[model samples]
Target: MRKRERENPCGVCGHYHKYEEGEVCETCGHRMLATSEKASVHFSAFPSEILPQFLYLGSYDNASRSELLKTQGISRVLNTVPACQNLYKNSFTYHCLQDDKSLSFDDANQFLENCERDKARVLVHCMSGKSRSPAIVIAYLMKSKGWRLERSHQWVKERRPSIDLAEGTLVH
Candidate 1:
């Protein structure tokens, strides 16, 4: 319980209290701790900028927020998690791929390439933004920029700092 408290301190009151699932903060009567725990653990303090002025990579939670997407000038979303809801379907051009390891990258790469050609900013996201999405971005770098898999992966890692590409997903 102490470990849980340490990991999930209340954002509002700054209290280190263990909260039961759905429990409100006792000290300040805030629900910060409860809500914080439900957010995507894959999120980083800073998401990766895969391509300057064109592509961003982030988690499902980040992709669902229309205001954040608008603020970043993201005109399209390439969601790698098929089951995840498209919260801003009408507002942004969307492309969804099922989160499967065997999924092909040809279409996704084409979509991203189109975005680049049109000068549109696109956000690529999966459930966690750690695996599927980054892999897609890496493939794009390889195809469009003519980079090898290792160099593309390294470049993404340097920018995002928390990307974890799944095993066997690296394409040359």
Candidate 2:
């Protein structure tokens, strides 16, 4: 620990900050709080199980929950965004998609399919469990279950009610 760290540590995430670091702690993406304030956690930190023990869908925060993932039997992860860091490479098998576009749907589905074949549980996630991650899960259903777009979507929606797809991401 550095001398500055010994002096002032972030109140919320407990990460030590240098004098130049200012208000927010870059380590945990949390802003420093005043003495009276308390830190809060995002509810979306836990992934929603989409398939009986085989698949889950959630946000980047969900992907970071290593111990929780292990408890849920998730041995692999399929990250839908390129920018989101893979928090536990050693703990879980991961395939980070380079981008999130319609063209990338096939690749995401292929990864999901492989995990299913191997009987491995995987968590598919983007920045939020809302749009990108759900889209990937929907695509996987279409290919694996012979379901049409609407049916596949409804299936995923039934499981995770929080999924809010952007208008442009939805097919007519």
Candidate 3:
């Protein structure tokens, strides 16, 4: 088992604790949700591997799960959403995009390219894994693998069928 986090965030009250799964959170006095409970779809429960071991895609919920990230050997996080908190900064390296309105793929893909070059396991995530984050991953594929947009989009969708790229994000 991974050692308990010395400053884990309590889901209910936002207080930090020395935390482990199934243990009681100090501030909220509520029992932590066990691992089985994290499988809910609403939780962005599992990460979709985009490049075998090197690249992964998930949601803010998955990004928040230190245990899950650790299990996957993910060492870096590319947070596509400005609003989602980088919850495990002490455990992972994070690159957060600043713009919420229209993110350019160039900057985002640069981060993805760097992680790939270093062979670091990285997760790219937004509020939900469905849209923003997947778009980012697709962009990375297009750039890194020299794939066209449609082909790249299809590739990620096949791996993570939950993806739903917003109409605004698609090119004609």
Pick out the ten consecutive residues of candidate 2 with the lowest summed lDDT.
33-42
lDDT of 1 by residue, 44-159 (tens): 52345788889999876577677877888888999786666677778999998854555559989989989999999999987556787888888899899999999999999887
lDDT tens per residue, model 2, 20-138? 44455455433433444323323555788888989899877678778988988999999877756787888999998885354398888889889999999999987657788898898
Off by over 4 Å in 3: 1-44
Number of the top-ranking candidate, with lDDT as the measure: 3
Q: Write down the lDDT that model 2 would get.
A: 0.76
Assess each prediction's global lDDT (C-alpha) against the native: 0.75, 0.76, 0.79
Clashing pairs in 3: none
Error of 3 at 93 (Å): 0.1
Comparing candidate 1 with candidate 2, which one achieves the higher lDDT? 2
Give per-residue lDDT, candidate 1, residue 3. Answer: 73
lDDT for 11 (candidate 3): 53
Residue 83, candidate 3: C-alpha displacement in angstroms? 1.3
lDDT of 3 by residue, 4-94 (tens): 4434465533556534456654433334455675464344467899889999998766877889899999999998877667777899999
Q: Which stretches of candidate 2 lie over 4 Å from their true place?
A: 1-42, 100-103
